[model samples]
Target chain A: METMLRKREDKIAIIGAGTIGLSFAALHLLKHPTCSIAIYDTRPDVHDYVAEYMSKTLAGAGVDIDSTMQRLRISAYLQEAVLDAVIVQEQGPENLDFKITTWAEIERYAPKTALFWSSTSGIPASQQSRNMQDKTRLLVVHPYNPPHIMPLLEVVPSPRTSQAVIDETLEYWRGIGRTPVVIKKECTGFVANRLAFALFREACSLVTQGVIDVKDLDEVVQNSMGPRWTVAGPFKSYHAGGGDGGLKSFLNKIGGTVQQCWDASEKDVKKGSIAVGEDWQIEVCRQTDEAYGVVDTRERDTRTRSVLEAVSCEEEVQ
Target chain B: METMLRKREDKIAIIGAGTIGLSFAALHLLKHPTCSIAIYDTRPDVHDYVAEYMSKTLAGAGVDIDSTMQRLRISAYLQEAVLDAVIVQEQGPENLDFKITTWAEIERYAPKTALFWSSTSGIPASQQSRNMQDKTRLLVVHPYNPPHIMPLLEVVPSPRTSQAVIDETLEYWRGIGRTPVVIKKECTGFVANRLAFALFREACSLVTQGVIDVKDLDEVVQNSMGPRWTVAGPFKSYHAGGGDGGLKSFLNKIGGTVQQCWDASEKDVKKGSIAVGEDWQIEVCRQTDEAYGVVDTRERDTRTRSVLEAVSCEEEVQ
Candidate 1:
């Protein structure tokens, strides 16, 4: 009986069973085969929802369906779900009041050692940590839509989140095959969404301004920057674009041009442009600013090159 | 002898054998085995450069080295190169004056029916079509970068460019394995770069503002939108994000939130933001607009899903 039941420390509590919550549960169940998941939600059909989801996706991957389903426990009571959870992942509604009340409640039931993770895309950990007794372990571990399928897990910590908890967060995500990047500060929209919305703003302007239509704009991106950025980020891409001189050369030659293009965009459309002066360009172009990892731009052995090659090669096959 | 010499109309002349010109030449040689290539450049080491490039790449692809080399013709005189050509791709210096004079000269020699393509990333077709007697056939057919490897070819037509030439340009590029999008009007930075710069600006702001350092920002992007965009463009991604409601639903629910996020970023950073009012959002949220192609967002079967699945699956493998 002892062998049949999962360990006490292996208890993972998931609050809320929405799309993101279900996906996160599925990810944990699929990736960490040995762990047990206790999901708590106010919805009457939470069990049916989980069962239906598992039925649909369980066949795709090589995960042990029956065992995974057996490992999952559905609970109506929040305290019962989080009683001994080693990790508490809340995927509740994006409402701040819901999160504040929920986290304060969770703090009372969850074990002292449990780390709290909120899947909110916008609301920061600081806002959610209002009534919590242990704010150090509370942080935003936002996933790019459909966490089960996406690779990015943005680990954003509030100002009060301790370094040890941050390290623990990183280790947990890394252990689960997630590419987690620690955002230094808790900004609106974090990092990925900010960059995405920024590009999207320009895309909207291009279409409305009649330079190109929405469909063609999408086609251009799917072909061009789509593959380019997939492998390398903007810095690495431009660094290589500079030829031998790297990012510095690229900035020296094209920063002015980028700035000019921005000015043109500004004149025609209201979508804002970033300052692309040598100083600003130089600032972001740094290869070694102490982040998670750094790919040497000179080697150009990035996923960008491989993805582009693969894309074109696939085209050749077609 | 006629077979060995190749046909007159099959002659594709590439003007200026610089990095891009050489890549264009290589792309033509490798992709179109039946067509003969005539490369014109003022460089003394043009032959050596071409030979070295061909040797390095030809082996990796299954293209016959001798056959591809046999179809190649390198010349010092531009007139001799373009005299019998049906297509002339100019990869000259990015100088307006240079393009103006070069097109004027090529106009005098090349066949009147020959379609002229300038691989200028920024200089618009309308601007470069100056000083040419036949502006109808000349337009900017810009490639993303490294024309031989990348897939996107931006086919931007000048206002005076004939409908026939635009069709011919599309046909020529599609015939060779390039995804060519038609830009309705010439704008600075064209489409891809403007979208790229817009994103880059926000990325710089995030770094300079200390929300995320340069390296982590790149990491977050490389993991998130990098793979996301590689599969589907922004509209499709957002459309899917809206779930069954489609793009309209997405704009209805998130457009206001996005607009708010932009305003917040604006308060902190000077980089521009586009209006996300329901009216403007409706304009670009359109998926069926008259463009080259349209992916039905309601289906939610765009490249975004496949790319994300693939990216995560690859992680599983690793």
Candidate 2:
């Protein structure tokens, strides 16, 4: 009766349906209503919980829950799930040994045309798929925490990954409303966390030295560069700093100092100096105290949801 | 008669009634209604323009204008302005020679008790006050661009700055609804910019290598680290990354990769690379033609203003 029955080839399979995997399946179904999604997990009943959560979320967001659910299915076996899929999103544990074993299995079972992506953050795709005969089809698509809400998806390629695979994966990521930044040259942790941790190391160094308290250190970023960085990156900020002439002018005047300071900051990755001192009693703290921590987290979550909703509704408005 | 009729003991002299100087004066007046503010500038009718702008801003924000203005008074000569002032906020041009001359003159005329603070991002406070006789009282209070809207003020003390001076300046900065993060050890661009640029240098390097484009580079920060950095610095981000264990667990898990990848990236900071190209306009065209050239600049500016406004209001509410 409908044209939908004719195009069943566009299918997605999600392996190891944990938090990241379930989120990917839900989001894929949300974006591609006509495309089917089959989720595989070692544990039973996790799919039921995921399905329930998705239905509630869709209802909360005023989306069509029945239609969204119609495109989603579940399987207990990865071999049966990914046999005819267009893409396979793997979200197994971060342990390297486990990933290597699973990835090799994925390479054996997944269709040749399917673009397989591992949601691993620390492990490089190259190392995981080294023994696979057709490793070029595999890449790392690491998403941030609460993957459904946060938009960053680090698309890192292995040395063997083809250009077409990267381009197709990029298209898939964008189509699903995720902000994907491709790592042309793959390195562990890709770009964001490495750069971030460098700053973290310096902040810890200062805090350890008693230069400032923890709260004040957070304030420094929240009120200062954090706001500016939301709009532009560091290079552009320096460009504006040069006032009229841009980066060249800024470096010409402050280049020596920048270099000197950078040299001083260089150190091998050190362990964190501070440790959580005690376990807190939830009963001792009042509702207000608990609410305070939740307030900031909730606000950030709301902002994220708003951004995603805006992106999804853009076409309708146009 | 009330105590309001009595003359205030503490006075602040603002050297150069530019945007920053005037905003500092207004902010101080808002906090301490009775504190005397005497502004000095070579430019004629500058105070009048500042006064007009402040009135409009205050009115828009539902603040009292005339009463606030009563705390402020402008003078034409530097000597007449700094006669009895306890703090001198120097917002002069960003030139080494100008700063050297200005500091020397301020040291010559101002009382021995007066502390001099330069609002310079480019010149280190140590370098600027190298020749001053009372360099111990000289420090740098480098605020973010458009100082009035931002609350981050980097209080960088020179080698000669006394403990007393730093403490008093910290008190003064806090009294005006501002947060001051001390630079216990001074380096180029202080803390925020140096950390910011380190990331920027890597981004440029990635682009130059054709690993990632300009737009994707921005997306990586926003979706991943940028939003989190708004609430927490890198240390805390990693701390949370540990899931429940905090920083120690996070680093322990990722420590190997961090060390491996620390040396993975090249550390050279060059001018605009071929990836970004010399002209950002042409580079943007190659990356994303729709948002290239003039349209990109306008979009960036609009986004910048929006973020600034959003964060300012959010902080105020908190």
Candidate 3:
């Protein structure tokens, strides 16, 4: 296993070149230029394809990544990926067995102190690291869809996971200009998805029950609290609802109503299966399909690239 | 039911001066120098106290509503509040019984064609106007909390509700510099809340099941999707996710993954009651409490008011 010819300055091994992984790779290469990155994948073609694509993508976006691209080598072999890397980002198949095998492989090939960060959404860090020899190094660093554009990364650690790994991981993410929220303990789906899914479920239930049409529902959120959620979270949102004193006042006044409503919400959410029926439901599906069809991702990607290029590095520090 | 004279050019009436009503009145008066709003509440003391406190609060915030305050009236009588009003913004109770009774009272005293908008979160326009002779005259115009800050409003109409009512209501909201999304059909919780609640339900479920802590969950969203959501909706978000062609590719490739995740999400959400047993969970709650409590609504309200004030009222004509 031959390592990439680059000086190890916080060496990072990216274990996959999927959407999130590639985004992180590009961002790391651009933002943390000092860090050495080697992408490892089971797919023989992914490494070369992603490397070439990112170089062209960045070059087109006017980002200077020629030297960084030179430093970024793809390793088809696991041992090469682990040789000098201090932090290993795993974006492998979502299958449990694949993860277990990957964990074993990381143990065998990676440095003793290297932290393993899985990008799994639902599979808990505890569950993933159960069979590992040194489970303390394992944690989930789950990023939303496009890791570069979206700043949040959920860092969920098992009970046995070390504080050193958490702190190091936090610094690594922050150094690359990513906002990382550390989960104090291991939990299924960690944070973002749990909150997101909760929202999705209620939306689905409403549509299923013929409450608001899909388009209208989407409009409602986009116009209303969605904008609020942009700047603040649910708690802050509800706090405003309380007026001058904040959430305590809000709860004191309307907490009973919310609690009562919360109790009623249980019976309302008809679970099991995506219940698709009615003309309106089909219309929503069709409309989404049509509207989505009109979207151009390359254009968006280019726009993002152009925007990133136009703005100074310091502008994005926030 | 004696009607009052038009005290000034900027005189307006805000009926049902509760949380929603007072917020609207305070916001409208603070932002726009063109009008002074008179808030009317059935509870005489509430009307007087709110009017007095809000005036002082506004004055403290450096917004001179003194001239507006001179025009401000605290009326216990609906007739007195509605007289000579260009528009009537009603934030009555959501209960169908209470609303119907209030509307009947307002109808007897007010002019036949005063643009009446209801700030009901739930209870559709159809049900609210089922007993009214002139059902087409009324429409449900729901706004997010701290209406001064949030520009989104759902202009929901009943099946029998006229398109004219919808257009007129939208204009009234637009006159106040609100972003209105007209919902053609009336449903439970209108648009924003239904979708918001859906997300809330799934979020609460995830929290209850110990999938994620409340604070970590909020951080992930606030930093990640929340920012994008500020600019675009889920469809646009996914459209960019597709990378090349757009949403078509996302739906074709990762759409299955989303559907699969959605399917699994059904079972994961815990039904009924939230029990926080873990020490980390208690810490999570405390963090959430502290975070929410620290948010200064006065600052937020001021920003909103300034934005509203900045909007060129003449641009609205074009």
Which candidate has the highest TM-score of all? 1
How well does each candidate superpose onto the true structure, as a TM-score?
0.83, 0.73, 0.80
Q: Summarize candidate 2's per-residue lDDT along A1-318 as a digit string, tens digits.
A: 123223554888888877678777767666666788888888768767877767755655556788778777888777888888888888888878887787788778877878889998778888888768887888999888767677788899888988888988887777666788888777546777666655654565445544555555666887666656665666555655555555555666666666555554453112233222212111112221222232344345455454334333432443
Q: Ten-residue segment with the worst summed lDDT in candidate 2 chain A?
A: A278-287
Candidate 1 regions with alpha-carbon error over 4 angstroms: A1-9, A271-318, B1-9, B271-318
Model 2: share of true interface contacts reproduced: 0.33
DockQ measured for candidate 1: 0.26
lDDT tens per residue, model 2, B1-318:
122223465688988877678777766676566678888888878767877857854554345788777777888888888888778899988788888888888888888988789987768787888678877888999887656556789998888889988888887777666778887766556677656655665666556656677667776776666666655555445544655555555556666666554555534223343222244334433443322222333344345445555544554555
Q: What is the lDDT of residue B108 in candidate 3?
A: 68
Question: Which whole-number lDDT from 0 to 100 does residue B254 have in model 2?
Answer: 68
Predictions in order: lDDT? 0.73, 0.67, 0.65
Cα lDDT tens digits for candidate 1, A123-198: 9999899988878879999998778767789999999999988888887777877789999888888888888987
Off by over 4 Å in 3: A1-8, A42-48, A55-63, A126-132, A184-187, A207-213, A243-282, A296-318, B1-11, B26-36, B42-64, B67-76, B93-97, B238-295, B300-318
True contacts kept of 1: 0.53
Model 2 / residue B49 / CA error / Å = 11
- Candidate 2 local Cα displacement, residue B176, angstroms: 5.2
